[model samples]
Structures are given as C-alpha cells and as structure tokens.
Target chain A: EPEVTQTPSHQVTQMGQEVILHCVPISNHLYFYWYRQILGQKVEFLVSFYNNEISEKSEIFDDQFSVERPDGSNFTLKIRSTKLEDSAMYFCASSEGTGRGGRPGELFFGEGSRLTVL
Target chain B: AQKVTQAQTEISVVEKEDVTLDCVYETRDTTYYLFWYKQPPSGELVFLIRRNSFDEQNEISGRYSWNFQKSTSSFNFTITASQVVDSAVYFCALSDFNRDDKIIFGKGTRLHILP
Candidate 1:
C-alpha cells in the first residue's frame, strides 16, 4: 500500500538552531498535517495544510514554526529556532478527503521523525 | 473544546488473555469522529479503526472488537486471545467535523503482553 514517508528518522540539534523535517505524503492525498508528541505525553496537533496554505494551527505552532509545500510532493516543517521543549517525535499525516460526520476521513501517518534539541 | 482521555496508563496481560483499553472523550460537536491507533515497539503508528458519531454500531474484526457508546461518550477497544505481537501503545483520538484542526490524541495506553 502507498504510505507517507518522512526523512531524517532522528535529528539532534542545539538550542536556538534551525531544523527542517521533510515528508512526502501520499500522492493523491489532499489534506496534510503535522503533529508532535513529547516524551510521555499525548500527541499534539501542530498544523494542517491544504491548498498550499495552512488551514489551522494550534498555540504550540507559534511564529517560530512554519510549513511549506515547496514542491508538489514535498511538505516540510521548519523551526527557525529550536527550543529544548521542541524535542519530540514529529508525525506527518495525510488524508484524501473529509467526509461527513458519519464517514469522516482517515489519516495515514508516517513512521515519524524524532527530534532531539540539546 | 475537544479532548480525548485514555485513563489506563499501562496494562499487562499474559499471552491468550483478553484485554480492554478504555477511552473517553469530550466534544461539543454533534458530528465528530473517534479513532484508535496502535504503536508497536518499532515506534510506528498503525491505524486500527475509525468510528463516526452517527454510527454507534459495535464492530468486530477477527479478535479485535470496538465498542462505541454515544450515551457515555466512550469508545473502547478489546483484544481477545492477545498475542505477544499485540504489545504496544494504543491511542484513542477525537476530531470534530466542525473545525479544521487535526485529530487530538489522548495519552496512550501501553500494553505489554507477556509470554
């Protein structure tokens, strides 16, 4: 089956440094999202992207965070200045369409990229 | 506000034992969705099941079954005759159709199936 793929299975960066995580969503998917999970914490939604723009974002997705679909296939998340709290596992997910409440769309998630900030 | 709660932090069961993971959610949207994902030791999340607000019908797939109770706002998963391969973290999630925000995951329940 086709699956979402993420680059840099693991990354370690110093505080105040920049880090970019890449993901290639399923070719036919129309909606993309970024989520993070701190160690021993629940997964938190970061942002959702559709039609080349962010559809929604959480408080955790502040100015320092940005997402881009530079190319048709590549979706990237960039943290301008990483903080220690940024250390977590970032997941990339995508869905083809959002159906009604009776048949909501299901997301396909990538393995995840583990980010470590020192 | 939409929130998902997985009260059981961790659960252990011997091989062949049946186990249930509890999940409760709070959502104001009349139209919403609930989901379950499994994270194996390899740290990869696998989608297990998705239940929408309109469908309260319980479903069973092989040894895995899901109970969706709209009255209590709870969606629970049960694994029967569990095997060693079933050891992993299971997460219950909620999403509102009225909003563009992504699914919200609860603190996962780590399941350890001892041999």
Candidate 2:
C-alpha cells in the first residue's frame, strides 16, 4: 500500500538554529498535515495544507513555523529558530479529500521524524 | 473545541486475556469522526479503525471489536484473546467535519500483553 514518507528519521539541532522537516505525501492525496508529539504527551496538530496553502493552524504553529509545498511531491515544515520545547516526534499525514472515496475521512500517517534540540 | 480522552494510562494483560481500551470525546459538531490508532515501540502509527458519528452500530473484525455509543459520546475498543503482538500505545482521536479536518489525539493508553 502507498504510504506517506518523511525524510531525516531523526535530527539533532542546536537551539536557535534553523531546522527543516520534509515529507512526501501519497501521490494522489489532496490534503496534507503536520502534527507533533512531545515526549510522553498526546499528539498535537500543527497545521494543515491544501491547494498549496495553509488551511488551518494551531497556537503552537506560531511565526517561527512555516510549511511549504515547493514541488508537486514535496511538503516541508521549517522552524526558523528552534527551541528546547521544539524537540518532539513530528508526523506527516495525508488524505483524499472528504467524500472523494467511500472512506474519505481516513488519514494515513508516516513513521514520524524525531527532532532533538539541544 | 474537540477533545479525546483515554483515561487508562497503562494496562498489562496475560496472553489470551481479553482487554478493552476506553475512549471518551467532547465535541459540539453534529458531524464528526472517531478513530483508533496503534503505535508500537518502533514509534510508527498504525491506523486501526474509524467510526463516524451517524453510525452508532457496533462493529466486529476478527478478534477486534468497537463499540460506538453516541448517547454517551464514547467509542471503546476491545481485543479478545489478545497476544503479545497486541502490545502497543493505543490512541483515540477525534475530527470535526465542519472544521479543517484537523485530528486531535488523546493521551494514549499503553498496553503490554505479557506472554
């Protein structure tokens, strides 16, 4: 089965440095999202992207965070300045827009990218 | 606002024992969806099941079954004759159709199936 794929399975960066997390969603998927989970915490939604634009974002997705679909296949999340609290497992997910298929609401997630900030 | 709550922090069960993971949610939207996902030690998320608000009927798939009760706003999952392979962190999630379809996950329930 086709699945979402993310690059840099694990990353270590210095505080105040820039970091970029990349994801390649399923080819046919129309909606994409970025979610993060602090160690021992629940998964939190960051932002959602559709039609190459941000559809919605959470408070955690502040000015420091940005997402881009630079190409047809690559979707990326960039943190201009990383903080200790930025360390977490970031997940990439995608779905065929609602009602496109009988099960349109289902989201397929990728094996997350673990980010460690020091 | 939408929220999913998994009250059981951790559970241990002997092989072949039946186990159930509870999920309670709060949502004002009339149209929404609930889902169950599993995250093994490898830290990879595996989608298990999805139930829409309109469909309150219970469903069974092999040794796994789901109970959706709209009246109580709960969707619980049960595993019958569970094995060691069933050990994982299970997460219950909620998504509102009227919103941007952002899924909110609850603190997971870690299940350890002892052999």
Candidate 3:
C-alpha cells in the first residue's frame, strides 16, 4: 500500500537554530497535515494544507512555523527558530480529498521525524 | 471544539488475555469520523480503524473489535487473545466533517502484553 514518508528520522538542534522537516505524501492525496506529539502526550494538530495553501492552523502554530508544498510531491515544515519546548515527534499525514459517500477521508500518517532541541 | 479522551493511560495484560481500551469523544457536529491508530516502540503511527458517524455496527476483524456508541459518544477497542506484538500505544482520534478534517487525538493508552 502507498504510504507517507518523512525524512530525518531523528534531528538534534540548538534552541535558537532553524529546523526543517520533509515529507512526501501519497501521490493521489490532496490534503496534507502536520502534527506534533510531545513525549507521552497527545498528538496536536499544527497545520493543514490543501490546494497548495494553508487551509487551517492551530494556536500552537504561531509565527515561528511555516509549511510549504515546495514541489509536486514534497511538503516541508520550517521552524524559524526552534525552542526547547519544540522538541517533539512531528508527523506528516495525507488523505485523498474525500471518501465514498461524502465522508471525510481517512488520514495515513508517516513514521514521524523526532526533533530534539538542546 | 472536538475532543477525544482515552481514559486509560496505560494497561498491562498477560499474553493471550483479552483487553479493552476505553475512548470517549465530544463533538458538536452530527457528522464526524472516529479512528484508532497504533504507535509502536519505533514511534510510527499505524492506521488501525476508522468509523463514520452513520456506522454504528460493531465490527470485528480477526482478534480486533470496535464498539461505537453514538448515544454515549464513545468508541472503544478490544483486543482478544492479545500477544506480545500487540504491545503499543493506541490513540483514539476524532475529526469533524464541518471542520477542515484536521484530526484531534487523545493522549493514548499504552498497552503492554507481557509474555
């Protein structure tokens, strides 16, 4: 089965440094999303992208975060300046616009990129 | 606002024992979707099951079963004759159809099936 793939399985960076995580969603998927989970915590939605633009974002996705579909298959999340609290596992997910019978599409998630800020 | 609550933070069961993880959700929208995902020690989120608001029929797949109750706003998962391989953190998530389909996940319940 087709699956989402993320790069840099693990990353360590300084608190003030920048970090970028990459993801390649399923070819036919039109909706992409970024989510993060702190250690032993619930997954939090950061942002959602559709039609090559941000469809919605959560309050946690402040000015420091940005997402881009830089290429046909690549979706990237960039943090201008990483903070210690930013250390977490970032997951990329995608879904084919809508499922049969007009139900919401089910999301397929990647293995996740673990970011550790020192 | 939509929310998913997995009340059991962690559970331990002997091999071959049956186990159930509780999940309760809150969503104002009548049309929504509920899902369960498993996160192994490798830290990958694996899709397990998905149920829409209209489907309340209890589903059974092999040793796995799901119970979705709209009246009580709960979607529970059960593992029958679980094995060591079933040890993982299971997450219950929700998505509102009226919203942009962004999933809201619960804190997850870590299941340890000891041999």
Question: Best candidate, DockQ-wise?
Answer: 2
lDDT of 3: 0.91
DockQ for all models: 0.63, 0.64, 0.63
lDDT of 3 by residue, B36-102 (tens): 9999998888878889899999999999999999999999999999999999999999987656357
TM-score of each: 0.96, 0.96, 0.95
Candidate 3 structure, TM-score to reference = 0.95
- Residue-level lDDT of model 3, residues A26-111, one tens digit each, is 99888899999998999999999989899889999999999999999999999999999999999999988755423364778899
Q: Write the per-residue lDDT of candidate 1 for residues B11-36, one digit (tens) a residue.
A: 99999999999999999899888999
Off by over 4 Å in 1: A100-105
Candidate 2: tens digits of C-alpha lDDT, residues A52-72: 899889999999999999999
DockQ metric, candidate 1: 0.63
lDDT of 2 by residue, B2-96 (tens): 88999999999999999999999999899888999999988878888888889999999999999999999999999999999999999999988
lDDT of 1 by residue, A20-45 (tens): 99999999988889999898888889
- For model 2, name the residue pairs that clash: none
